[model samples]
Target: MTAGVETQASAKVSAPSASRVRVEAAAPRPNMGWIVPTLYILFLMLPIYWLVNMSFKTNTEITGTFSLWPQNPTLRNYIVIFTDPAWYSGYINSIIYVVMNTVISVAVALPAAYAFSRYRFLGDKHLFFWLLTNRMAPPAVFALPFFQLYSAFGLIDTHIAVALAHCLFNVPLAVWILEGFMSGVPKEIDETAYIDGYSFPRFFARIFVPLIASGIGVAAFFCFMFSWVELLIARTLTTTAAKPIAATMTRTVSASGMDWGVLAAAGVLTIIPGALVIYFVRNYIAKGFALGRV
Candidate 1:
């Protein structure tokens, strides 16, 4: 009876200690990993914070002092932009071209990416390298050529001109991103579908497309960002009707003077669409990189 009691006592002691050790092992380490990212985020956000602060201040307050926060904030700057046809129209023009560019880049790149990933065609490597080379070429070199080309087609000063121009860079990038993701997927899945009597188009549409949906989202987001932010090409292509917000920003500096408040407000506004785009695709970005084609 005494030996049995001693054995029960030992069991209770060992169980608690094992449980404590397990709890300790499962506990997370102190998060020093976040320090760099936190600092980077702060660095990125500071300029945006300043711009937003400046947007709320009046012209006098902005010019008078360098303060982190406005003493007297005003909504007049935002009102000015929203009410004015010139200011609002610039946003509309920017949206039209950006959307058009994103759609064209994604659509064209998807097929090209599929071809590159799935097939071993003639001059495939040379063709891909050539396509990527377009992105490497200086935008300045193409400015004149783009103007001449669009002018010949009577598309100068139009959204289509800017969209087409953006595609010169974005399409290649989209194709590269998508091809990487597509290549990661197993060929066995494709073979299985073919053996199961599924046609190529139907199988691709139903099975392969869903697998790389994350990559598509990521590529689309990148296309939108590049097209939206591009200043030189958009400016060179569009004269008035489709003039981007980046070009509209130049209007703030004229012969008479510089409108700093309006400029700050416009700058703050430019960030909104990009921010929204990033937010929507943020989840896909992580997956895109993780599951990218081998």
Candidate 2:
């Protein structure tokens, strides 16, 4: 009798387990929502893939073929860019001005950002807005004035001229970005450092700067990208000696028509520096948004 009772009790327990297994199996699975984003990413990449495809083909093949890829892949387009002085110097000049602009913009913006975030002065709000207005003004508006000013100083056709001209836009953006990040840091940090006998400059350099390193990285990345790609000011401020790659690419067009393959190759090369910059600062960019400091 006891054995039969024990068997009945075991069966009761097993019944609930079997019912739960059935319930779980009957539950609805998540929908495949991921398909939309995957499709969108592929769509965005299609033009880039086409550009790369054209870069590897001869100009004649590019016009003649309807194929998705190069029919006869060749490196002659890239070879021309690397081996030619005019083509390669454009890249060197671009890098020089871009790096100079990024560094100068960031350095100047950092102190101004700190001032905006940490202190209040007369007309501070108006001053800040005025700075942003400079950024908002079209580069075309300043191109003539910049050319005339740089000409007066005998600074035309130099990398430094382009770097300084780009600063007119980039400095404001850097200040705006860095100011946002600096405001997120607590005022208590300043107080604590003062209590420990740290001077203002020393505290700011050693203590405050590290806290907002990610913000600086993000700001620098923006500065770098803007200066790298701004064709109008860079082109206007420079001629042959310091002409950027964007301006150099214009040479591909002639009375004979465009050299499609070489133009495509130049476009591909132009993407590399920006791509490398993004890769290096990607972590900082991700962190900046997460920390609400971007």
Q: After superposing candidate 1, which stretches have Cα over 4 Å from the reference?
A: 1-30, 254-256, 289-294
Go through the candidates in order and give the clash count of each: 4, 0
Taking the tens digit of each residue's C-alpha lDDT, what string does model 2 give over 1-294?
Answer: 557877899887654554335454444788687899999999988998899999999988988778898889999999999999999999999999999999999999999999999999999999999999989999999999999999999999999999999999999999999998899899999999999999999998999999999899888999998999899999998989999999999999868788999999999999999989988987777765443443
Cα misplacement distance, residue 7 of candidate 1 (Å): 47
lDDT of 1 by residue, 81-200 (tens): 999988989999999999999999998898899999999999999999999998898899999999999999999999999999999999999999999888878899999999999998
TM-score, cand. 2 vs. native: 0.87
Instruction: List TM-score per model, in order.
Output: 0.88, 0.87
- Candidate 2's C-alpha runs over 4 A off are 1-31, 287-294
Model 2: how far residue 197 lies from native, Å: 1.0
